[model samples]
Target chain A: NAGVTQTPKFRVLKTGQSMTLLCAQDMNHEYMYWYRQDPGMGLRLIHYSVGEGTTAKGEVPDGYNVSRLKKQNFLLGLESAAPSQTSVYFCASRTPRTSGKNTGELFFGEGSRLTVL
Target chain B: EDQVTQSPEALRLQEGESSSLNCSYTVSGLRGLFWYRQDPGKGPEFLFTLYSAGEEKEKERLKATLTKKESFLHITAPKPEDSATYLCAVITSSTLGRLYFGRGTQLTVWP
Candidate 1:
């Protein structure tokens, strides 16, 4: 099974350009998240969705917006990209914990490397 | 403020050498600690989870243990294929799904 899959494994964009990264998961998890990883910095959450039609801001949400149009897919969009936005993006999904919140055991996609020039 | 710190930013070991990676955190209402391994160009992969102090879990060449303020990921008899960046994260609050992560310990095992 494709646990979690992300599209556009690699991309290069000019400054001010716009793009979208797609994430799909077959685990039927209730929670999905978007994160970016940089050197010396662990994965930081960009945005997340608790379920379909619901999205919330995360630690680094300024340059990105997310939508969960379907239960199995989460889309991350950069309306206007910047050079600082270049980073490796990852998508993760997990079943809820006993308290109904995601408790750290997450399955992740390979990652999408975006280079903004 | 919640913080997670992992020590030995990087490590290099020979095949069969054993070592451990450390993850320390400070947060209120600790819920769980998680360990993940990420290969170059890949996303982090789940390794283990520790809910409370003294808890331990084992996989083939890895073992994870937790305490009130820190967690350890012990790698026993490593191989080149086992080299990867190891990440540590903590689920601090029950109301939020956010997992605070550390910088991670990058390991390289030379065969």
Candidate 2:
């Protein structure tokens, strides 16, 4: 089973360009998140969705937007890419904590490498 | 603000050498502490989770122990394949269960 998959594994964009990264998960998790990884900054959250049709800004949401229109897909958009946005992006999803199970672990996608010039 | 910090930004050890990586955090109402291993050009993989202080979990040669303020990932008799970046993250009561990650510790086990 494909747990989590990301599209456009690698991409390059000039400054002021726009693009979207797609993340699809088969786990049917209720929580999905977008994160960016840089050399020393580690992985910083960009945006997240607790359920379909819901989204919330994260620590580094300045130049990014996100949508979770479907239960299985979460899209991250760069409205106007900039050099500072060059970083590897990762998508993760997790099951909710319920009376039957109280776990907080995330399953991640392979990651998308984006470079803005 | 919640914060997670990992120490010894990088480490190199000979095969069979035992060592430990540290992760410290400052947050209120912590829900859980997690450890993840990430290979180059790949995403972070879940390793272990600690729910409360004084809890410990072991897998193969790796062991994770948690305290009120910090956690430790201990590698016993390491192998070259154990080389990777180890990340520490935490979930707090106020985050809506969202995770906050640390800078990570890069470990290299030489043969």
Candidate 3:
């Protein structure tokens, strides 16, 4: 089964342009997250959703917006791309704690490489 | 403040040479600690999870051990294919669904 899949594997945007990265997971996980990875820096959370219709800010949510319209999909939108936002983006999904298992592990997508000029 | 730190920033080892990576964390309460291996141009792949102190897990050439304040990932007789960035992340009591990640340790194994 394709656990987690991200769309637009690679993209290039000029400054001030807008784009969206789509993440879809078939694991039926209840929680989904968006993160960005840069050189010498760990993956930083951008936004997360505990479930459908619920979204929350994460450690690095600025300049990014997220939506979880469905249980299996999480979308990350950059309203206005900037050079600083040119980083590899990752999406992950996790099962809820109530799954009666040690469900702290996350299944990640391959990642979407975005470059802003 | 709650945070996770990993060191030494990078490491280079000869084939069959063994070494360990360190991940130290200070948070309000520790729920679980996780290890992930990331290769170039790819996503981080899950390795092991330690829930409490004095716990250890092993797979292939890697062994992960955890204590109250830190976790260690030991590579035994590494091969060139084992080269990758190892990441450490933690789930705190205050942030059940969120994981705080360390900068990660880049490991290079040369044949």
Candidate 4:
């Protein structure tokens, strides 16, 4: 039951560096989301994908980019890492809200902690 | 504007104590309200979902009740394992799968 898995459980990057966070889900869900968790800020959505090739920006999408090229994968990219971008990133996936039994239930990954200096 | 708020940023309780955590929201059209439990260095885990007013759900030592404007998660006889940050979120008409989250309430149950 590898619900959702994120790569590079921990990472540290220098300013101006670029990296990608990979998220994979085996649940065959159609909705994938990326959110960053900070103290006193809860979890703010960064970007999300509705299907295999559709992506949309969320509340805090200034410094992040996302792509969903396949149904099982969603990738979050940071072109230029900043100290302010240091946060714990969580990836979640859920089935579409098409059925009464499967509406608005999100399965999340363990989380990836990133540090920038 | 849609917003979700959680009261009492942090709470401390002795083992076996009972209490409630509050989540308030003001959204255009409420689709669903969600509760999650987050531990240190981990992502939030789904707990319960309330669809409309006057709905109640219970699991183990936690019972959740919802109204039009707010929802309450009542914890009965909390144990140390129940200590974690409780998060509240909402999905409205403007958001399909996106969730607007509250700042969360950190709970500590000392044994």
Can you write out model 4's per-residue Cα lDDT over A1-93, one digit (the tens) per residue? 789999989999999999999999999999999999988999999999999999999999998999999999999999999999999999999
* Off by more than 4 A, model 4: none
- lDDT by residue (A9-74, candidate 3, tens digit) is 999999999999999999899999999999999999999999999999999999999999999999
lDDT of 4 at A58: 95
Top-DockQ structure, candidate number = 2
Instruction: List DockQ, one per candidate, in order.
Output: 0.70, 0.74, 0.72, 0.72
lDDT of 1 by residue, B17-89 (tens): 9999999988888888999999998889889888889999999999999988899999999999999999998
Q: Write the per-residue lDDT of candidate 2 for residues A62-106, one digit (tens) a residue.
A: 989899999999999999999999999999999868554445689
Question: TM-score for the second chain in candidate 3?
Answer: 0.99
- lDDT for residue B22 in candidate 3, whole number 0-100: 100
Candidate 1 displacement at residue A88 in angstroms: 0.6
TM-score of model 1 (CA atoms): 0.95
**Per-model TM-score on C-alpha atoms:** 0.95, 0.98, 0.97, 0.97
lDDT of 2 by residue, B1-111 (tens): 788999989999999999999999999988888999999999999999898999999999999999999999999999999999999998888985488899999999999
Model 3: residues >4 Å from true position, as ranges? A98-102
lDDT of 4 by residue, B52-110 (tens): 99999999999999999999999999999999999998988889668878999999999
RMSD over all Cα atoms, model 3: 1.1
Instruction: Report i-RMS for every model.
Output: 1.4, 1.2, 1.2, 1.4
Q: Global lDDT for candidate 1?
A: 0.91
Ranked by DockQ, the better of candidates 2 and 4 is 2
Candidate 1 per-residue C-alpha lDDT over A1-117 given as tens digits, one digit per residue, 9 for 90 to 100: 989999999999999999999999998998999999999888998999999999998889998999999999999999999999999999999987857444688989999999999
Question: Model 3 compared with the native: what TM-score?
Answer: 0.97
In candidate 4, which residue pairs clash?
none
